[model samples]
Target: MNPLEKVIWILVAYVFGCLNGAYYVGKLYYQQDIRELGSTNAGARNAGRVFSRSAFIVTVIIDAWKVIIPLWIAISFWEMDTIILGCMAIALLLGHLWPVQLGFRGGKGVVVYLATALMLAPIPLVVCGLIILLGYQLHKNLMLIAMIGFSSIPLNLFIFYRNIELTVVFFMMLSVVVIMHRNGD
Candidate 1:
């Protein structure tokens, strides 16, 4: 893709990601902003806590599709390279973490990150997901399990792809999520 096309695709991904599912669901169903309830986070967990389990499920679906749909379309139609894909992933994450329409306050970007990870490295994502499930079953600690699973993405990417650039991209995406979560966003 040309430079302009790349920019456009990245922008599209950001805009799609900006469609914060938790906020919309909360507004439409609960008549409240998700960011103003529960943990005050516009994320699936917060939505579930403040609204209903169905809200959480719907938020997950929306957030995942927001990343998956645009990236899939870009890949299928444009066949973007790894670098452009990496940029797009970062843009999507940024949009999720700081949607412009929501006063730059958005979700923690876990769903967006995982959705991109599924697209970029399916095998690693599957392996990590299984590990997360096992860890969750064993310890029943979401935070610890998530930390372990997400931290493994870079190593898994390197092992699977044998490409430093891809590994770096994974690391960058992971860093963004970690930082956002660390900031309590």
Candidate 2:
């Protein structure tokens, strides 16, 4: 794709990412802002904790599809390369984490990261899932298990793809997630 097309697709991904499912679900169904409730996080887990299981499920589906649809279109239709896909993924994650309409406060971006990873690397994700299961069995700490699973994505991506560009893109994606979580957002 040309530079202009790349920019446009990245922008499109960001806009779609800005469509926060938790925020909409809370507003439409509960008549409240999810960011103002529970853990004050506009994420599926917090939505489920604050609202209903259905809210969580819906939020997950929405968040996943929001990333998946745009990436799928770019991959299948436009035949975007790894760099373009990486740029779009980063843009989407940034939008999800700091939506302009929501005063730059938004979800933690875990779901967004997973969704992007699902599009970019499905088999590695499954391997990570098994690692997560093992981590869970070894230790019951949610944070530890999550870290173990998430931290492996880059390595797994590298092992599977053997492309430095793709691996670096995913590593950058992983860095974004770690930084966001570390900031307690």
Candidate 3:
């Protein structure tokens, strides 16, 4: 893709990421903002809590694919470097945190970050998932487990992948994710 096309693609991806499917799903089923009821964040976990199982499944599927599909589309058609793709990933997370469709309110960004790790580093993603799950089970603190998992990304990337660029991206994304969830702590 040309430079202009690449820019357009990123913009489109951001918009897609920003769509508040969870909020709408919750409203349709529960007559409430899922975020306000659970974590007060317009995200999948909140949707899962305040709505039916089907709505939760739908929200998760939509949120996960929203992040994965656009990046896959960009990589398939565009000749952009990892750095540009990394920026696009950041844009996607930001969209989740501050979705224009949700009056600039948004989710905790876990879904988008999950998609990013799945596409960019599958091993780290799996390790992180396990850590989060195990941590949650052991400590019964989901946000703490999430922080631990996000923290492990940079360490795992450096130790295993030995990629400084990937480490940097992990650090950047982790910073944003943690900051967005600061109130939960």
Candidates in order have lDDT scores of 0.88, 0.88, 0.80
Worst 10 residues of 2 by lDDT: 176-185
Lowest lDDT sum, 10 consecutive residues, model 1, at 176-185
Estimate the overall C-alpha local distance difference test score of candidate 3: 0.80
lDDT of 1 by residue, 1-185 (tens): 57888899889888988999999999998899988888888899899988999999999999999999988987898888888888889899889988999999899988988898888888888888988999999998788798799878888878767878778888988887787778553
- Model 2 C-alpha lDDT per residue in residues 136-183, reported as the tens digit of each score: 998998766887798788898777678677688778878877776784
Tens-place lDDT per residue, model 3, 48-84, is 7667678878887888888888788777776567776
- Name the better of 1 and 3 by TM-score: 1
TM-score of each: 0.95, 0.95, 0.86
Tell me the number of clashing residue pairs for each predicted model. 0, 0, 1
Clashing pairs in 3: 35-40
Candidate 2 error regions (>4 Å)? 183-185
